[model samples]
Target: MRSRPKEPRVPPDRRETVRHEIVSLLTGESMTAREISGQVGIGEKEVLEHLGHIRTALRSRLVVTPPACLECGFSFRKRERLGKPGRCPVCRSERIVDPSYTID
Candidate 1:
């Protein structure tokens, strides 16, 4: 039987590298957690955690655009924190837009 090839090991400093990359990407453009995950080669959950930790370290502000409800066009702009909303307060629609982040 042939053995499967092992995946390359991640560096010990991978978390720091990912955090740096996240800031760089956000500096260029605003993106959702999903988008950051794809570009940074990390899970969305990891991206969220990193964002939480790096909030005060960045030179520019970390802006989070709150998730919006698509059904009623309700903008969740007043939300004071990061993370997706459970449902639309106005329409109760689960079809909500994921919040995005940008450093500016």
Candidate 2:
């Protein structure tokens, strides 16, 4: 069996990535992962994944407003995940507001 040749790695500066575009979109206005997905033409889950990296890359610039339960007025201020909560712990309601992100 013959071994296949390896592909060349892209240089960091030459790679055209979406992280910059994502940062630009998040500069002033706040948006949910769904909203970002729509704008960037990616899935919501992918947006959340990008956000995880962005949080570290941008440091304090990326601000995440925590999700809140609409039914019970419970705030998920301490929650760390980027995605919306499945259900409210306090009232067991699924009507939870999505966490919004913005760049400061």
Candidate 3:
């Protein structure tokens, strides 16, 4: 029988540190949720949840650079708080870059 590898344990403080780093990365440039998830080694859905808490901690000073439509110049403001939109409402473009939110 083969043994499975043990999962790495991350402390709460370390997790918070990682979260803070994520916010810092978003301060200037926008990053996709998938990218963030990959960097943080967590699920994309979890990144959204973490963002909610991070926003509240930052007192709504979170700068969100949501994905914009290239054809119609439509921004995903309505669906800005969470993950990236599947398609653009105005142009129906499926190409969406992940939004980045930072706490200032």
**Best of the candidates, TM-score:** 2
After superposition of all CA atoms, the RMSD between model 2 and the true structure is: 5.5
Model 2 Cα shift for residue 49 (angstroms): 0.4
The candidate maximizing lDDT is 2
For each predicted model, how many residue pairs clash, with residues at least 3 apart or on different chains?
Answer: 0, 0, 0
Q: Tell me the TM-score of each prediction against the true structure.
A: 0.79, 0.83, 0.66
* Model 1 per-residue lDDT tens digits across residues 37-97: 9998888888889998778676438988878888999999888667788898898999999
| Structure candidate 1, residue pairs in collision | none
Decoy 1 TM-score against native: 0.79
Worst 10 residues of 1 by lDDT: 10-19
By lDDT, highest first, what's the ranking? 2, 1, 3
Candidate 3 local lDDT, 1-104, one digit each (tens): 99999999875456457667778767766677788888777788988898888887888777677777776778877674577778887778887666765555
Report, for every candidate in turn, its global Cα lDDT versus the true structure.
0.86, 0.88, 0.74
